[model samples]
Target: MFVLSVLLLIAAVVLFLVGRGKERSASGWKLGAALSAVAGLLAGLFACVHVVSAYEVGVPVAFGKVGSPLTSGVHFKSPFTDVTSFSTRPVDLNLNDDDVVEVRSSQGGVLYADVTIKWAVVPAKAVGLYRLAGSEEAVEERLVLPDSREIIRNVFAKHTSEEGYASAREQIGSEIADLVKERLAPRGIDVTFVNLRNVRPSKKLQEQIDKKIQQEQATERATEASRTATAEAERKRIEAEGVARANKIIERSLSDKVLYNQCLEAYKEAAKAHPVYAVPCGTDSNGTPVIVDGSKSG
Candidate 1:
């Protein structure tokens, strides 16, 4: 557009000069000159005016050299210079199953991860970014993607497959984001956030982890059962000891006189229940009691 405007302006100048020199065809030349001038003015206005959206920053290029950055809103530049706009808003780059990254674990097991990186070009560095990286797509392709993959691989290599799938997943992502930020900040890209959406170990590794967990649970249960059985045996032993102690106290209280009195009371109770009865008067040979009926003794 700028080139066409310059061409139209040149044509108008040529026509105006020719009109002034001619006497008979001067009005025709003047009319053509006026039209050309109007066209050139509109084109020049169009080329010089630029609107940078709220989310975008513009970089102006003069001839072949890159110029300063332009913030959001209307801006004016030379019609000869071109302004290129790039979004300053956060952009999400997802690397999922479709673009899964394979990495090795500390234990030499393979792991796959799905990740996302949220980033944007630094607004102040728009012109420098354009000069260095060309475009947003180019920045992602040349810098973001390769750097993210490399950082992830390096971080994952420091962890085991179980760690990748479990406790260390988030930490791994954070480390990647930090490293990538350090690597790209000097180049005008800002790494805002990184997410390790999913990490999966190989099928064999997963099965082994599951088995190990089951074995640990079983061992815990067995330990608990052993503790319970030992407590029960201790309780039974204490109860038996108490019963034996009570028996010993009772046996120590008994005497020969108490036993003779008890035997006499039993014989008296039996005599009241029967006219003729046998009773134990005393102990005879072999410690056996000798009983005689009252009628047989008479």
Candidate 2:
């Protein structure tokens, strides 16, 4: 504005100096004066127009009223109109991973959680977000950051330390994602990811947890050992029973008379292979191979 005013003053001075005497010719002086004012006004108007950037979208407003949104590139509007440019690209928010959230477990113990989430503004919802939140700072302040934290806290509180730490990790993240999506969907934002970075128990509780796990593992090992020992004892008992039953069957099949008959047959078969001389002493007494009265025996 200052530069334009200076140029206009100079133009006026030059016109005054050259057309001072020509003022007597009213028509000529008026024409010169009119031309000078026209040039100054044009210069001033050019100075008032600030260039709308190509990397941004401008929201033009007349007086205090906002008009239609403008796409990036070059555009012309009234010099006095207000233009507010907004970003259409994605904006990333990085949250800390060590933030602790307090939650009461099913056992009434307090659980601490540390989590991190990476997210961005959805492109299509940028306009609606701008309308509600006014700016990027407002978006985080009013919607994204607060709601994300709320979802995390809500989901964390429902599960115990062990459940939240390992067992229900996927479940918790899914719940958080769902909650965020539902909350922000109306406002034109999408919850891209909800990550559970870490979960820690209290120091005192940690010691107890470690001890419990160890005890459980030891008990399982002992049970397995007992099962193996019992299996071995049962196998041995079955083998012993089988051997005893077989022995009883064999004993029942053998007899003293059978043994005596087998021995007589063996002796008869042996006598046929050798020459023998015998003299019988007594005929009244029953004698079978009695060698005491025999004179010679084979």
Candidate 3:
């Protein structure tokens, strides 16, 4: 558009020179000159207009100097200025195993985190972004990716290796998101959220973790066995005490008359089987029964 406007203006200048301010032919040339000049100025005006899209904010730059941002609509600027549009849409910057972030836990154990951060350049801050980082790619390189990776590492560093690997992973992600947002807001990056996934200990750290887990499992099994044995011993003790109590109760309940009846019943049963008769003998001082089994003479 700038080139077109310049060409039109040149045409107007050539027509005005051809008129030379003279006769009928000159007068006609002069009219043509006036029309061409007007058309040129209109073209120049058209060249100044910039259309910013709904999801974009444009910053005008002329000869290395940055201008105020243009919002989502038509705006006019110096025809010499070029508008650079920055997207305000959320974009994913996934740092998977391909870009794993190395973190040292508080316990000095090493691990890696696979992170995905959703972020966008703030529309109102687009001018600042232009001043700081020129392109969207530059913003990620200089501000977004590096800053987020460092924040993730720092947040994970505050926890033990286990927390980074599994235990407090969600909490670590939240912390990372908060820190990245806080750190990059002034730099014109709006971090929506940080997702930490596929986190695990480093190779050496993993071997150590596996060993620790195996030891814990063994200790648990031993403790359970000990508990079971103690319970069994307690149950046997209770059973023996019950049996002893039962015997004592039976001994206390028996009297001399009870013993004598039991003996008599036994003798009667024997007589039933062998025709024997039970003959009572005098009891001793303790008064237990004495009985003799006599066979019936046939």
Candidate 4:
């Protein structure tokens, strides 16, 4: 740890105190003085040596003054400084974990969702970031969390509960990423991707939407049934009219002579089958005889 150098310095001070309280010529006094010198030297050397990992950059601070960012690998610095580490790689700030945010929609319906924002330290502006926020975690607390939460809430508020869970979900995430990027970019943080996932509306609102959908479906079924019944009734009416028209045509064409001829033909067919005779039963309007079966005449 970087603080190991500070501990060494304190030990050196302790050794120096022990030597001061002893007799100048004493062996114990000489031993304390030598140990004090060795401790001080070691402290200085350890403080100057900083080991930064591949994913991290170190910012050196000395006597309340901040210096330039030190990139990965071993760096030599002054003995009076402290180093703060920040990652150059992408960092995930998960709003779904401990940072869950609950938002109210435009229609005052409650919504909950999972959100993730990916960001990274801008290398060129690391010194400025270190000056503004003491550490990476401090940057999140002071900058990332507050801005992101507010942006998300504001964006979601522009949509209704139904839109929040469905239509406007993707748009909300995109607005968050853009706005957060605008705010953090000036302060050395690069916002990458924003993910919106698992958006859920409150139970009451969901039930309302479900009920409305069901009612619409029922109405559609009723309308289709009505149309089917009307079409069937019209088809039957049209068929009845056609049959009546055909019967009227046959009535208009028939005459008394045709009827008398039809009866005579029927009588002759009966006589051939049995010993039945044909007789004149009546006269038509044209003075034609109406044939009848003689055996059945009473």
Model 1 stretches astray by more than 4 angstroms: 6-36, 225-282, 285-298
lDDT by candidate, in order shown: 0.86, 0.68, 0.85, 0.81
Listed in order, each prediction's TM-score against the native is 0.72, 0.61, 0.76, 0.74
How far in Å is the alpha carbon of 84 misplaced in model 2?
4.3
lDDT of 1 by residue, 1-298 (tens): 8889889999999999999999799999998999999999999998999888998998888889888888999998888887888888888999987788888899988888999899999999887778767888888888889988998999999988878889887788788888988998988888888888888887877788889899999999999999999999999999999999999998998887787778788877877876546456576556445555675645
* Model 1 quality (TM-score): 0.72
Question: Candidate 2: where is the Cα deviation over 4 Å?
Answer: 1-64, 77-85, 98-128, 197-205, 258-298
Counting clashing residue pairs in each candidate, in order, gives 0, 0, 0, 0
Residue pairs in clash, model 1: none
Each prediction's Cα RMSD? 5.0, 8.2, 5.2, 5.0
What tens-digit string does per-residue lDDT give for candidate 4 at 1-298? 3456566556667666766776674567656656755766676687689998998888888998888888899998877788899998998888885567888899898888788888888877888888888788988888888888898899889888878989877788788778889988999999888888668876887788899899999999999999999999999999999999999998988787787778778777877987666674357466555444556648
The 10 consecutive residues of candidate 2 with the worst lDDT sum are 276-285
Q: Model 3 clash pairs? A: none
Name the top TM-score candidate: 3
Model 2 — TM-score against the truth? Answer: 0.61
